[model samples]
Target: MAGPGGWWGRKSTPAKVETYTRWSFYLIALSEPLVIGVTALGQVEARLALLFMVPVVGHVALALVLVSRALDWTAGRRPQPLGLLGAVGAATAVLAVTSLVLTQHGPDGEGAETVLGAVFGTTVTYGVGMMALAMKERRRVVWLVAGYGVGAGLVASALGVPAVAALSMAAFMTAASGFIAATSCFSVWLLNAVYALDEARETRARLAVAEERLRFGRDLHDVMGRNLAVIALKSELAVQLARRDRPEAVEQMIEVQRIAQESQREVREVVRGYRRADLEAELSGARGVLRAAGIDCEVSGETDGLPAEVQSALGWVVREATTNVLRHGDAKRCTVTVRRPEGRVVLTVRNDGATAPHGSSRAGGTGLAGLRERLSDVGGTLDAGEAGDGEFRLVAEVPLTARPALEVVS
Candidate 1:
């Protein structure tokens, strides 16, 4: 692994990055012998083989440096070019010197042949190894490999050892660069496509959720709207009939009860889809509960300035508070306030709900917990506790969105 201090290094990343890195190393590895080997092949007598060793050494050094860098990249490091090039030069020198000592000298005929083979084989390995380490872009440095291939091909050719075969190898190495570039380009495109597909999937999920909400809203409007209209009409009819004749009015009275009961049921069901209450609905529901419980209800201040999200949230608070008041506090009166002044939307529900019931206190339940979460989701909070002895007040405040209703409607 290359450390942060150095320029060229491998750092851990995706497989595609690694693949390109591997290919780059391959190019470097194959370049060395081809470069020096081909260029020196035409006349390999006297110091010719020694001359051949120069590029081979250069190639080996370059390969070592590149391999180190690729490893560094694999380990999540980026490399510096000058430092990387220096390392490559150093490695080629070592390998070239090693090859010179071991194989550059000719022993007798058989020994000369064995030494040459060893040198050539080692040279090839080092060349390939270096290319494998260099970054994909850096594999351009492996053009030196083509030199080796061409030289070897030419040596085999000039000596009548079959030059075409050697040059063909050169052609193959030369062609690889284009293949490498093409594959890298394709990988980048594939990555982008995957990201785009993920984004599309996410958008569809959001749309599905929204459609489900809209469908529920329609069903709620149908059920509640029709029942409320029928109940209102039947009540009116019962009133008129009561004035005209007692027996006939009594029959209308039964029908009114039936209609009222059905409307209430429908409202509760509609409420399940969304606790969809506006300012008016909450006030009306609160008023009825207070009247039924023989408590006085009072609300103050305009809520028109509040956003629909905030209004809907506060409406839940009002309902839960009112329910607690009647069922637990035995409240005689309750006051609710919704107002915006000084850049804040304020909501308060207060009652003598802090009083214990028959010398016992009641534990809060899901309604209150749910109201807290609801308010929090709208960037508000619920605070319910004793304002003083025998007095309970729940205060909630949220930022006001000026066009609250229109925002919700949209």
Candidate 2:
């Protein structure tokens, strides 16, 4: 996944910027030890240099082993805390013993640079140890760092080194140690935070898809539920009449076929996301459904010679309004009126016995919001609100132009 266009994907602008930052951290980690190693080698003979390298290599190896677990934790891998603890303890012990040995084996007349080089070698052990301790126990880590700096200063002072020099080294090492440790810990924590956010975003996307599926299921049930029931009733009647006269059975069977065909068309419309309404079909369906539900429904309209865009937009308004009347309120009467005046086509649906919408906002349901979006694209508008005492009204208007229809069709 490290290769090009793999897990990192095609490197974006942000990723390219981070490349320099990532390299800077690595260079600092590597150069700290190298600077100390090179400075020690220049000041000492080959024999002493070899001896010096032994403890430096050992301490750094142990520190690296200890910090590897923290790296693993950042990468969302298992943290071997027990092994990390062992490595940290071993590194600290080795660095302490090495510092005491360096003090005893004073560099040919106590050269300050050589002694400081040996002391600087302890940085890796202290830095990695501090990070481990900080992650586990904050208070204890502060005291541990303080004790390490003081102990190193005491060791240098006991070797009869200058008081001022020992104190300076102690302060310098302490600051350097804290800087490396804090940087490493913070970098890992930031990466982990980014990973968590990505997971949360993916989870939300999945939940949204699930919500859409549930919405589609509800709409399908609403559309086909009554139609299927009517088909069942008609088929039963057709079977009974077939036993007596064939012509009556034939008529009932034809009605069942028509209902089934309409249901299939409605299902297709819901699935394809191209659900433009037909004025005649919507008007016919709404009247039939409303009357069957025992509500006195009256529709007044001149739907002839209208542009396709106007018909599609207003047809959706009629259909949604009728659906709301059936599903939402307890109504005795509903009126649908369509008029074309002054180059505007207006369709109004108003009903008595209006109840509060099932949800908070009027456009909370997908149907109304979708209708509004559809209307907007075709230079049209929609408004739904309480009209008067115990009544709600929905009004939709569209420009009478063939341009919108062309745009919608294309």
Candidate 3:
């Protein structure tokens, strides 16, 4: 019923009145076999003329409806792909029907039946093809819908589908349509779900980093604050006592200054560990810890000329290895080597011996996991275990040109 005036009166997106409008060609396409079957009962001489009456009634009504729907879609600015499907489907159905009617000599004849059947058969084939070629697996339900279409064509050809049989078949087809439509709609749903989850995860990650930064700042304040206050008080007391007890006060004041300077450096490096990796500071820290623990620490190889990324990652490896030696090794000494071989950076941390059960290795810990993740982003890696007789070692290699700070330090 949509005319020039009527088509202008609707809004778009979630298009209204598409149920009947989109399907009008389907009714035309469905009735092709019916008209041919009906013509089969008529006389040969007048059959063509009578068949013309069916086209004017059934075919023309069907075509007008489809065209009007296309116009409505265009006016409403329907999506290009859906609009294309509607246009193509309508055109194909019209062509198929026209060809069948023109090729027919008369009613009740073999040639006429063959032509009409082929027209419907081709449509069924196309529907099946679309379903088969659909990108998503669930969309294959279009096969069942296409099968139903073929069955409907067969039933309509007889011009005598019982009401009960027609209803049953229609119900089956509608169910299949639901499945196909659901498959299409699921893609949109999945995309939205993935997008929402990604945003949530990113938010959580940011929160975790913020929380860790806060914790680090608090720990630094607590540890260094008390130590610095003690050092300051000792220095003041030593200065007052220096006027009388010169020898004892001189030693105390020297000790106080040394302790205060070391503590201040430690605090600066701890702050850097939270926000950055400072190579020279980390190396100095490692040297201090191992040397204090009665282990002779040797740092060798050229470290001064390395890129920032290589230096930083190697610095982490040094930190973790020193931490391990302190916690587990009862070694006399540890040799730390940084080597650049064939344009790649390598770090080796070797301890003489460990005070632990024989023939066992710790599976992994957070420090190791953190190192691995950092290395992996830059196409680098860590390999750690016993490397020689009675010696434990950790080795890390990174590309000199790698940009881990840009890629991973986030």
Candidate 4:
């Protein structure tokens, strides 16, 4: 039931580029028969026109198949389409020869030469362009185009065309086919670049997550490692003393219990600090991260008098929203604003170039759900959805008066 607009909105940036490139080629292929074949029908006899149209239509169909397979191959979705490329090349040569024969021996009309020349030139140019998509090397594409030009000249000479006319045919084929070939090459390059950029963005987000995890792990180890070592040594000493029936064993055991309790409290503090995000630090971090990722990020906010709980809740919102902007949509600009109004702190993260549909639940994953839970604990609210004009906005509001008591996990 989705309309074209809805369907288009759902596609990612790379997907959209791929669709445009693919359909552009499809239109080019379809235009051949629609334009050139119709012209041929008007110039030639109906029966002869059908004869020429049959092969042209068949070539167009073949070109369509090649376009899909060639694009798929370029995208790494399929193996190189060597067989199809060969078949298309052969078909193009056959069509070119047939058109030349028609020009020389078939019905002589005012438009026959023009129509035949178009047939020959169009078939050769289309074939070379489609074949260019399968080629990864620019040198190979250059050679392919040059070779086709030479082949066109040689074929014309074999059909008794004059030397000058044959050279002219070669030049025309070279220029036309080279244009199409260059277009095909550029399309392939642009598509590949778009995909590479998308991959890099995803990789950067993953690396950011991974680096944070490593930091947290290092913090936990630094807090607990020496304390656990001390506990083990004290327990061993207590065990040895108790075997000798010594009163010092009780003292050592009590010391061991005290150290264990202290270690537990220290671990809890570390975990609490790890979970708590500072609004100022998060805003600074988001600005740097987004800008590093090529997004123009402007952050205007202050957390000077905000309570710790309010800062923590909104800080989490900023982190999650920034990550989504990098990983989900193709955001080019991000604006994060924090303001205190109506006895509440409002934090808004708005970004443009969002590819997600309007009113979608979330962009990437359940990060939004987890964020909502975190905000709810501090009496904060989270709102996120696509705004108009390819923008996404996330807003988190926490009352200044709401300061939920923090509990230390034992």
lDDT of each: 0.58, 0.66, 0.57, 0.86
Q: Would you estimate the TM-scores of all the predictions? A: 0.31, 0.54, 0.33, 0.94
Spell out the clash pairs found in candidate 3.
Answer: none
> Candidate 4 deviates by what RMSD?
2.2
Which ranking of candidates, highest lDDT first? 4, 2, 1, 3
Tell me which residue pairs clash in candidate 2.
Answer: none
In angstroms, the error of model 2 at 155 is 5.4
TM-score of 2: 0.54
- Model 2 lDDT, residue 409, Cα: 18
Q: Which candidate would rank higher by lDDT, 2 or 4?
A: 4
lDDT of 2 by residue, 47-112 (tens): 766666676666555555555555555455666466666556656655664655555674554543
Q: Over 4 Å off in model 4, which ranges?
A: 354-365, 405-410
Q: Which stretches of candidate 3 lie over 4 Å from their true place?
A: 1-275, 355-363, 405-410
Residue runs of model 2 more than 4 Å from their true location after superposition? 1-26, 65-68, 104-107, 116-126, 129-144, 150-171, 240-249, 274-410
Residue-by-residue lDDT tens digits, candidate 4, 244-283 = 9999999999999998899889888888788889999999
lDDT, candidate 1, equals 0.58
